[model samples]
Target: MHSFFVWYRVNRDEGDADMVIRGMMARLACRSGVGGRLIRKRDEPGLWMEIYADVADPARFEPLLRQAVDEFDVEMFIDGTRRTECFLAGDAIPAICA
Candidate 1:
């Protein structure tokens, strides 16, 4: 399974970012069957992250995620581009990397 972590820095005064993010997450869950968790960085005002774990189908999830971002215009609330990372369990790592 795959897990995705996406982080970004939001615009400081954007009070509506949370609402928009929640809406996007709902849309993503409905469309892709993947629910996400949103969190803020400790002691950091503008840093936030969204985590989606146990993804069995990254191929299907990725495009839906991109689509949701575009549909919700999530970039307007952020200072820069969002950064996304994917991780696999330690036991699932490829033999070539071991």
Candidate 2:
């Protein structure tokens, strides 16, 4: 399995950040081979993150993500510094390293 982590700050001044996030979640939930959870940083009001687990190849999954973002117009609600990181579970965890 592959895992992807995305982090960003909401542009709350533009709209209801929570509502925009929920809309994004709803959109992504309909995609196959992808499952994710949305989270908020307790110490940072506008900061958020999403963790996705997918069995599909990253090549396949990345485009799906891009499409979803475009379809849902996510960029309008997020800050410019949004970031994403990806990993293969077995390769990324120190405890699993030989």
What does the lDDT read for residue 82 in candidate 2?
67
Name the best candidate (by lDDT): 1
> What is the per-residue lDDT of model 2 for residues 36-85, given as tens digits with 9 covering 90 to 100?
88888898868889888764578877777777778877888887866989
The worst-scoring run of ten residues by lDDT in candidate 2 lies at 89-98
lDDT at position 4, candidate 2: 90
Residue 4 deviation, candidate 1, in Å? 0.3
For each candidate, give its TM-score against the true structure: 0.88, 0.77
User: Which residue pairs collide, candidate 1?
Assistant: none
Tens-digit lDDT track for model 1 on 4-80? 99999998555799999999999999998999999999999689999999889999999999999999999999998
Worst 10 residues of 1 by lDDT: 89-98
- Checking candidate 2 for backbone clashes, the offending pairs are none
Best-fitting candidate, measured by TM-score?
A: 1
